[model samples]
Target: MVLPISRFWYKFSLFLACLLVFWAGFYPEWVEKYYAQAFYPHWSRTLRFLLGNIPFSLGDLVYGLALLLLFWAIGRMGRDWGRMGFRSASWLWLGKILHALLWVYLLFSLCWGLLYVRPSLGTRWQLKPVAYQKEDIRRLTLSLLDSTRKYRQRLGTEAVWRPCRDSLVPWTLSAYAPLALAQRTPALDQASLKPSLFGAVGDWVGYTGYFNPFTGEGQYRADLPFVLQPFVALHETAHQLGYAPEDEASWVAYTAALNHPSDRVRYSAHLELLGYALAEEFLLYGQEGSFAAFDSIAKENKARMDPGVRADRKRIRDFFLSRQNQVSPAMNALYDQYLKLNRQEKGLRSYHAVLSWALAHQN
Candidate 1:
């Protein structure tokens, strides 16, 4: 009687696992926000950091060993089950199905959390700027950099990146940082900056710094111009840090790169933001004057964009838009749902909305 009860429970577990796998694939947003914040956020930052990050790094080694044992067990089980006729074969089949369902659940959970929950939580706690002004931008940028410098003094030079990365979250808290500190802050208008041309046709650059959502590990094109690389790197790093919303990631990346001590890094942040401002102006205003301003900035950028950089951008563009790219409309829709679930009113399109906030506060 006890053995029969145990078998029933095992079968029920497998059934529930299959249901969750199906739900996760079809309606990931349903689980993204509430689950992460409710379960994962209560832990101390140190504990969360250890469990989410450190364990994964170590888990890779164990995973290798586990795979070896898994293969051995499967081989042995296949031979043994083959001789047991239908009764044992059915149990083995059930076990295999249960294992597949569990794998799917884990994959869906990670993707949903990374693309939805991380951004929502980070944005919810993001520091909002109290004021906006050119001088304020300059002051805040400098102040943030000073704070990072102090952090480095305590942690040593090797720990410099931590301060730099941490500074990004607070840098875009207000309009002041964008207006005062950025070296070439451009005026925003539809004519000067427009929505990405690719976006007009439902195509997107999708060049985020994070790994592929499904596989959770894959290299992306890294051929952007040096002037743009640092900011892009920081933006992608923001995604890796679990800030999935595009606007938040952009702002965070801008702040990180700007606060970095390296001149090149600062320049990269400024240039990337300037490009967005110009793009926004072209799309929204389309005024001749705004276009003129954009042309001037573009010429300046062109002079700076060396032959190698141009070639690299082209290569990267090709790679991002190629058939091998893994993005899909369903994925975009999933992102949209998650955005709404996280309280972003505009959904996935909110990425472009950051320009409004940037422009309204521009010095």
Candidate 2:
């Protein structure tokens, strides 16, 4: 007979996942306060410490075994189809998969999904200092351009260009020391960032990195250009630290990376934020001020950018553009829907909202 234990837990886990969904949906306001006060800080630190010092990913092994188990289960059901009876074998294995899925969802929700309901970092920081005008954006852009030039010269060779390929874990950890950690909470300091198991998959999908709520691991795509890795890793780690919304996380990541200990990493952060600032400047001041701001980039800064960094810029552009064909419309639609469901009304454009947040810090 099929084991009764498998069937019971499968159904029970699904029930709990559904219950948590509705409970969170209806009472996110309450969850925000309660989770922040009673659960989040302690829970995040506990998970962080559990595997933070391991140097390798515990989540990776768990995932590898899960994939192997999936294949084994599929084969077992096929092999037993006649002896166990088709109906019985099918239910036993299918129920096992469903049980695993339910438990995964339940774990994910408890660990990270509730963070989506938390108040934005904006509210925490109170960014109402928008009185500064377009001149501020231009000034910041020039400063970032100047900073970017200095770092490019500091990073003289391509030796550092191949960061993720050479194992970026140490540099990633080191980059965190200069952060203006907004909460001032002590537990966040215990958290550490690591590389992801699915780093290859990240390259294929244009994923920079993602915070694995399952194991509280911060992993970045292993194939990103060396310059982009530090800030992207920090951004994903912001999620692990309970900053849920993309824009809010971007703001924190930008703040942290712009002030990072490594000069090269600081320039990389500014470079990323430059694109955002340029976009906003164009919107606010139109082509005139925008081009004028570009003109303001120091001649030495412009001259310092040789062909290699230009190639890196081209490579970064092509990375996303080339991946567009692989990403089906259905996937895009699904992500757009997911963002919308999460109150991201601007959908994917919400990521760009960090520009406004960046400009806010200038004054």
User: What are the per-residue Cα lDDT tens digits for candidate 2 across 60-147?
Assistant: 7777788898889778778989789989888877866776766766777787777777666666677742544567776766666666
User: Whose lDDT is greatest here?
Assistant: 2
Given candidate 1, what's the lDDT at residue 249? 65
What's the lDDT for all of these models?
0.45, 0.68
Residue-level error in angstroms, candidate 2, position 160: 5.5
TM-score of 1: 0.43
RMSD of 2: 5.6
